[model samples]
Target: MSSATGPEEPDFPAATAARLDGLGLLDTAVTTCRACPRLVAWREEAARVRRRAYRDWDYWARPVPGFGPPDAPLALVGLAPAAHGANRTGRMFTGDPAGDVLYAALHAVGLASRPTSVHRGDGLELHGVRITAPVHCAPPENRPTPAERDTCRPWLARELTLLQPALRAVVVLGGFGWQALLPVLRDAGWELPRPQPVFGHGAEVTLRHTEPGRELHLLGCYHPSRRNTFTGRLTPAMLRAVLARGAGLAGVPCRWRPGTPDT
Candidate 1:
């Protein structure tokens, strides 16, 4: 994950270690994360500051891990852990207002089976979508430094490989995610001369990767962060439209009959 989308040395080994189940890999990664000391400190501080809200809540005191159905084909790349969101819940896109809207949209589109994402314990699942972040640790002000992104990418690379053999399209949430994903595409020898056009809401750019010569459809969207939604920077329909386009690009059929609600 290069900061400014510059080509970097490929860190993904020709092959990764034996792939483990999704949950098992997530668990191990969380335990071994030491890429950024600042993020770890910030996450701990956020938890302590909001300790009252989580007095009875079991705070997962480690880098939040991504979670989804084990065999999902689509990977959702979010920016980073929000201070009170994944940083507190120890799961990507969980325990936050943003997740409420995201999970609902997923359910509407028939990708997620659950309507609410209360916490990691809630039995929410995705049919084809798996979520991960550019950085595992929660950074100060929710903004990760370039050093942090570069340092932590090994985890992301590993997660991608583990989820692979099934990975198809990846949806990057914002510019940061798009930047992080660029090196990944480059490593696979899929670098475009002109950087892929970046715009919020489902902009589909074809990614060229060799070895298997798969065309990975890259979709972009505004992150479901409180700063964007609470201030009305992004509308619910706008977000849904992006997801809908992504579903179409991924060849997921729409089942919203005239008389039926999206759910």
Candidate 2:
């Protein structure tokens, strides 16, 4: 609950994220971040200039917080919040089409309590899995500049550090998250390969942590964006399989359903 400018006022995100001791405090600080002016404006503008379908709903225009348990064994990393989705729900990936598919896949892999995430208070839950993003705010055109990404990375790094004790696996969605997360992993104690790993759907890489006998399984999967899903690049089964692998590596049990994908 502490920060450079005290608990009530958080200055730089990197400084703030570096000092925060727990995920709850980190989430609170993330929501109050206005460090990125462009993102702050865009998120608020989307809230004020409402989408017709969501006109009656109050939008959570601030930076969205990562969702799920504090002691998760597996973590799912995403690029950023969809402008109309997480930007409106206050929780990462909630109220979005991608979330619908992502949560469903998690449910199939026994990582989520439900197949849908409609809002922050939808009563849905995750089991041994935490979902987060590189950027907390919704970026314009769904693209965050490299500078913005860098500015936001301390949060992710800090989150991963907090989860490191229990974390055994990480599933990164899309190339952006893959690229953003590598440096964080290296800085957090995992040894990066000689050549940086290239991202691809279903790509899997095992990393050795500085601590003896500590290992991490990193998996890549296509983002469940409409383009990927509609083009069959990332199907229900494809997404489910990668999630299952990530969870399996964490030694978390999966309650298999009739057609759950296995990696």
Candidate 3:
């Protein structure tokens, strides 16, 4: 099922893209990602080395991608997968400490099912939130090359377009994802704030498009990586605050209660 080709010209018709109000576009995008072969091969190799970590677990053979309600008003954009996390579990923000921090925050903010993320078969799901990484593949040392990031940018663009109806705000998880988003916004002719918005927990801005001033909210936060979480650089409360702020910008009231679906 592995194909060594780049993303095809998206057959996403305007009408089809328009109809994706509540589709599972994240799952589809993950299953269809064909960005870079180097990352793909590295992910596969990581899987082999980490087989003991997932001995009784199911691993996604291809690049692990994002998953959640496609038409959700809030979209969580994370950095690339960790070699042992999404790369092994085949689900964004799963199978790692970072996933734990993120899932816990989403759960607290009325987006996810629970505070803990497990294997692919764990049955947990996002109700009104979608999770995606700037780079699809887990880069070495968790850092993606510039070319790889550029190649992956179009995928995020198509995702945003397809999720128009419910896409209210984009929560960027790290500096890399935030920087990657700039080019996309520029391509869409959206105006950026002066000096650029700095990355911090709960820092957000609304971007205006020229034609009729249509807008999308942009928010920033530190990455929910193991390094960040374990070092206390990011906490569950901090992450929750970021989501709550983004929810406010989107005009989506977060009924942040355990197990309460946001949809």
Candidate 4:
């Protein structure tokens, strides 16, 4: 469960462990992954250079793992880590504006313990929800190429499989995450529609379970990036609505409202 201590070449041990190990072991392996050459170089470079504001800080500078309870019923899929965000803080959607919007909405809907996530040890907790990404390493300019996405797919696929027992709904953030997640879900034995469901804010699709007891739902939401939030393309109310819907689909009650007191 230790972080990568130095720059290393992309290796297969981590990937193998992700498929064979349990949640805790898988996450530890994920942090040490160096599967993509470009991603490995970029994430390490960013850490070494350091941002002006965070010059005094030490960056995690490794692949970021999914964060939250192992048996979470609700899951969230984000595109990738922000260069100075998760790539620095070692936690998904932390230390960034995008996280600010997302965690706040989750908190308002009674999913997250706090509305703000500054770092890993900030005491923020997610109730029945886990946050993950297609690409663990932060790519340059906040974008991972198609090859990189495909290379990183196994980790997510394994993660979903491990979560299948209790996972009922997944909220994918942005079109990238939506596209990236669908195939993984299908590969994990969920029966996706032939035409495939399109991605859009508030878009929802229910896939039949391979085991035939209950279905799994896929929910979409616009990424809570600063671009969308600052431009009015996405509002707190909008994000909260989508999350509330997902919670309901998962059979989880969301008692917190727009003006409800924080838990």
Q: Could you give candidate 3's per-residue lDDT for residues 194-239 as a string of tens digits?
A: 8887776667788887767488899999988778888888876677
The CA-based lDDT of model 3 is what? 0.72
Q: Which stretches of candidate 3 lie over 4 Å from their true place?
A: 1-34, 256-263
The count of residue-pair clashes in candidate 3 stands at: 0
The predicted structure with the larger TM-score, 1 or 2, is 2
Q: Given candidate 2, what's the lDDT at residue 154?
A: 87
- The prediction achieving the highest TM-score against the true structure is 2
lDDT at 159, model 3:
74
- Superposition error at 183 for model 2 (Å): 0.6
In candidate 4, which residue ranges exceed 4 Å CA deviation? 1-18, 257-263
Tens digits of per-residue lDDT for model 4, 171-237: 9999999999988888777898979999999898989967768799899999999999999999988
**Candidate 1 local lDDT, 39-115, one digit each (tens):** 76787778777756777765665777777765667778988877777777777888788887788777776777876
Candidate 2 vs candidate 4: the lDDT winner is 2
Which pairs in model 4 have colliding backbones? 10-34
Clashes of each: 0, 0, 0, 1
Evaluated at residue 55, the lDDT of candidate 3 is 71
Arranged by lDDT, best first: 2, 4, 3, 1
lDDT of 2 by residue, 9-101 (tens): 324777788888999999898887887888888999999998899999899999888898999999999999988899998788888889888
Scored against the true structure, residue 202 in model 3 reaches a CA lDDT of 66
